[model samples]
Target: MVELAGEILNLPIPPHDEVLPYSESCTDKSVHDLNADNVVLCRAGDDNQLGIILEIQREKDKRKRFSWPA
Candidate 1:
């Protein structure tokens, strides 16, 4: 798993300034509580404007391919 994780980490990383600070993993438990790998949020200060969730796959999983779109 380390190799797989390392491979992912080797990818180009974007600067924090380019992305809003609101972007983070899904951790809220009150509402829908699904631990998302990473979530990109477009926001201005405290206001959350939009979100684009990205799920990581270390290996091939047929279910993930279909579920990721949801």
Candidate 2:
């Protein structure tokens, strides 16, 4: 797993999805909730803004679950 520091953004923000590329191991969420922190976890490709990375998935076996927004 790769770690990075950056903000979280949605579509029509940066319009770049090549920064982080894709994961063949498992699916990834475009935007993740930080819950109590108010922050979010997103792929470098999906993020438009730039923030700092607080944490990352240390376990390679942990396949991230992704879903379509409602």
Residues 1-70 of candidate 1: C-alpha lDDT, one tens digit per residue: 3234336667433222234434444434466556566656555566555455556789998878786453
Clashing pairs in 1: none
Per-residue alpha-carbon lDDT of candidate 2 for residues 1-70, written as tens digits (9 for 90 to 100): 1222322432233333333322222223756433221233334555544322233445654344332211
- What is each predicted model's overall lDDT from 0 to 1? 0.52, 0.33
Off by over 4 Å in 2: 1-33, 36-49, 65-70
The TM-score values for the models, in the order shown, are 0.41, 0.19
Worst 10 residues of 1 by lDDT: 12-21
Q: Count of backbone clashes for each model?
A: 0, 4
Which candidate has the highest TM-score of all?
Answer: 1
